[model samples]
Target: MPCTGQREREMTAVVELEAGGAKLGLMPDVGGSIAFWRCGEMDLLRPVSDPHLIAQHGRAVAGYPLVPFSNRVAGDHFRFEGVDYHLAPSFGGENCAIHGNGWQRRWGLDRLANSSATLTLDHAPTRDLMGQWPFSYRAQLRYDLRENGLSIGILLENTDTRDQPVGMGFHPYFPRHAGLKLGFAASSVWTNGPDHLPALRVPVEGEWSFAHMRDAGQEPIDNCYAGWSGSAFLRWPREGYALTVEGSPELRHLVLFTPPGQPYIGLEPVSNMTDGFNRPIIADSGVRVLAPGQKMEGHIRMTVTRC
Candidate 1:
């Protein structure tokens, strides 16, 4: 038989492993910002260029510009490592700065066979950053996708000879419209001002308790939970699935933000609490400082399973 000019192309491409009759779209470019990651057949992880997406996912990572720094002078102004650094206000502020420099830059892509992919981003302390938070450092974000979930690992290295304060956090926007619920095991809660920066540290209060399932619609937040058990349990009852977020013991804090008028919720696993720069350093708290030529690395794994 002679073949006609007709050909067929499938609509859905299998980007990664398959199980339970569902194909995973693990590494296809979703949009301009995020690489589309499907959790087996559970849900589609949409990556967008908009910052609001961070708010939409309930827990998308936010940094380099977390919240916004309103006051800044020439050279990005601040002092660290025994030096006065200046950083041009990326968001235009004059009083102080917010979030370190990381997210705004475009990261490089390194695909690892089929099971995983790596997103390598670099932040070389600019004269602006140097003038504000004076220190030479490198930041990297690595995303590894698997059959059941994805793990985000962050590494920050000190390139200068002096010790500097470093604060890193993960912002994940979780789905909220469904029967979504959040639960975690933690002991301390940091007090913050109306602007959402740390004001004090106190014992965990009622409702703030996350040892049990709590409806997403019932609570409002922009606060951090400290002395965590280093774990959190998240579930979408409507979807019949749950995700256990496991962090390193070094990752002692988790920030939960329930913004007004958003469909998603944020469950951020942070190495330090908000306004970390201005907050009093707990006996052993604050960003990890490494000696020159030294490196520090940590992991935050999110494992999802159907109920």
Candidate 2:
């Protein structure tokens, strides 16, 4: 079903997908983001309450996809194939390019069903837009709602004339409440420098460890974890529910962001580490170079269960 709402002067529309008691709300016109998701009466994602903020900042919504690359690119520039590529700072007042360009641009609805939808964005070379990336490409996002949870697929193809460096990921914001626990197995975590660029890779230990289910207390965090096991779990004892996150093996990295005092946390599955393009000499950096006409695809599934 289709739903429309207005926030300030900008109007936004949502496409609803339902299966059994699970419902997903998507806004293809707003950065192809997930407006809200619920299973029965329980919210699986943090719902955006401010309409004006939703109209102005799509990334601030529940969930948004990252394409071509994920996380921050230091100095807003990188070198590929002996050519230096520069990107305009997409995030306001930030000197680095964050989360690629997908989450800020509108995606065209390619197909829609009662419980599923497909959206596409063609990044054709343009003077103002496509220059952010050195190559032209097409990105497709498919959202399928199941009886228990939601499944998202991301497909990116290199339509440029030469090879291109690529990476991708998903940013899902879940409700962070008391008695909430996060569990995931990761081998190492990156320590961020003053500018938020990864400065060192250290073993996961102490407060940075998530090897078992434990309450994510008020410790501030905004760092990337490497060597993820492709599986994660979230438990909310107070809400009597839990969610299991599973992603493809290509998503070898995860970024956790727990803003101080915010009622939400970001558990992201990404294909590369932060500033991966700048560290091309590192063999396990997770950056992929795709030749012309090549394509890369990955999927992430979130299943909810009542405790």
Candidate 3:
């Protein structure tokens, strides 16, 4: 990650990495986000067109790491270790906290290289902030750009003295165009209730089935698919390119969110299903509890190929 570009935001440094005609732009200060990823003139990840917008909208960035937990935690609350923790609503309109605090705070640059970079965030339990999580933890994210594609690794360590519930994932936005096809292996899908919590777990069939490569269609999908095979494929017919996404086995759940009429699709490789903390222990809900000083880590790789 030979660094370039001036500070874009308040103390927010923008770094660019290049390898084998592939380029990646990173904003370490902006929740360790990837501003854009491109190979030649084609975009492998959806690029943020306006730099000014990223400061106010971190989710609109090309990609960002999800730490501590993934997705909503019901009414911004969860019980762990016989104690209840309440998190303030992280998003604008949503009543529950979405994603984790990592995306909403700045991360420190740990290391930088020509083709890779590492960012770290250390969260200590404080009177004001700890009320939301009630635990101390350290999160590390590394982005490596290879000749074929990009690989992202996330590590979460429970720095507190007590046990803590943990989940992790990656939210990467990909360009969605007409004639695009998606394929993945998942045994079931999680239906959301009115509050966007997991209402039910249903088998993957009919419109929710993506066993074979097929167009995403017009139906809106904002659900988590359980029993994921840890791999997925997205093909762009109009661009004559395809992207293969593979994740570590720890990432047993896949959350697919294709907002109607949106130009991009979010295929997230997550460690747990929605509201995993509150749900019963199931084979597909990839939730885990880390003891004091314990750490959990996972990786996701994206390879691009010409169709």
TM per prediction: 0.75, 0.93, 0.93
lDDT of 3 by residue, 143-174 (tens): 99986799999999999998888899998888
**Model 2 per-residue lDDT tens digits across residues 225-282:** 9999999999999989999999898899999998888889989999999999999887
Instruction: By lDDT, rank the candidates, best first.
Output: 2, 3, 1
Q: What is each predicted model's overall lDDT from 0 to 1?
A: 0.56, 0.87, 0.85
Could you tell which candidate, 2 or 3, scores higher by TM-score? 2
Native-to-model Cα distance after best TM-score fit, residue 217 in candidate 3, in Å: 2.3
Lowest summed lDDT over 10 consecutive residues: which window, candidate 3?
Answer: 50-59
Poorly placed runs, candidate 1 (over 4 Å): 1-35, 44-81, 90-96, 128-133
For residues 116-222, could you state the per-residue lDDT of candidate 1 as single tens digits?
54555444556544533456766555656666766667777777767766766665666665667878877778666655556677787686777787876645777
For model 3 the local lDDT of residue 62 reads 89
Question: The CA-based lDDT of model 1 is what?
Answer: 0.56
Model 2, residue 222: what's the lDDT?
94
Error of 1 at 87 (Å): 4.0
Q: Against the true structure, whose TM-score is highest?
A: 2
TM-score of 3: 0.93
Where's the lowest-lDDT run of ten residues in candidate 1? 63-72
* Best-matching candidate per lDDT: 2
